[model samples]
Target: MAMGKTPGNRDDEGDEGVFAEINITPLTDIFLVLLIIFMVTSTVIVQQGPGGGAKAGLKVNLPKGGATDVTARSTDLSVAVLADGRYVLSGNVVTTDELKAAFDKARTENPETLVIVQADEGVPHGTVVQVMELAKKAGLAQLAIGVRDGE
Candidate 1:
């Protein structure tokens, strides 16, 4: 009678057990690549939309201007004037009184805060003036206008 060989011993059968451990290096590499691509594309879409405008709020067609780029700061307050005479403060649609109150609060928090008015090209000059006056009345001395870079 012949004796059976152990599992680890070399035998004439030349049989090896199934490979139970799975290699996940390739799978992990593929996932990382996909994640990187998604992150990059999302950033581009957020910064510059299909219209190539760096707008994070309401879509306003900024007029061309020769002014240089103004670096944004922490104390900067953004207000948007839509073509339909609506006011948007920091992305929220606000009434005139609410806008005034927001301006007052911002001024109280930081006397040197700068208000950047982003008005659509079709917005009337008078509407923009009213917003500016409100800001001034709120004691916000520093003010600026948002414009598209002249090309």
Candidate 2:
């Protein structure tokens, strides 16, 4: 019997010793793959920021707000304010005058029309206020601001 070898344990040519050391290669590979997957998914989520409904191509980072139920209705007039100071009314890029005109038209068509302003987080407060003023001047009584849902 050799040193540290038992009598019943045969050291045959085909019998390798017990694999005491753990093979970390496969574990490391799995971790790297998972890391890659997470990286890709996180980038996609960041690129596709909040508020993608109604306006498909427009990207607006809305400010966080409390939980509220705000759903789209046929009488709702949706407007978007981009960070670059551009206004989009019903998915069409428009000037301030154009937006006011659209709002007036909608209000005339439906007295109960609601104006929803979806402004980016970087937009100036004055701009948002201007939009609200436009809605008010257009005689649209109901107005709402779009905001991201959070605590």
Candidate 3:
């Protein structure tokens, strides 16, 4: 009897039994290729999403200016002004009245909180100013307007 062959199996040349071993090198190679393709495609898709150049909650064309780069601290807050005059605080849509409360709550938690306003280029100047004033009234002294670094 062969070590890995069926007892009743025999070949014309007297070689018997089942091969019993699976060749998986080809299957492994195919799977690895597929994994690489998926990784590349996923990265490309993410890179092409809204605010591809930077991480932003809403899609906004920032005003171009000679702005310096600023590192955001953990205590920093983000507020976005949509083109349609809507406000999005930290990715959540909020009304003008709610904006004050949100900023107040954030300020109470961290007195040194910094507010970064990210308003679309098409947004009215008055709207942006209103949000800034609200933030100030909320006791958040540190305020910063988000802009794309003209690097």
Best by TM-score: 1
Best model per lDDT: 1
Off by over 4 Å in 3: 1-68
TM-score of each: 0.56, 0.55, 0.54
Ranking by TM-score: 1, 2, 3
Looking at model 1, the pairs that clash are none
lDDT score for residue 142 of model 2 = 91
For model 1, residues 1-151, the per-residue Cα lDDT tens digits are 2234544566778654555456688899999999999998988887776455455546666566756667669889999999999999877899999999999999889999999999998999999999999999999988988887797
lDDT tens string, model 3, 19-105?
A: 666778889999999999999897787678886644634676666655555568887889999999999977789998888888888
**Where does candidate 2 have its weakest 10-residue lDDT segment?**
1-10
Enumerate residue pairs that collide in model 2.
none
Where model 2 places Cα greater than 4 Å from the true spot, the runs are 1-63, 66-68
Candidate 2: global Cα-lDDT? 0.82
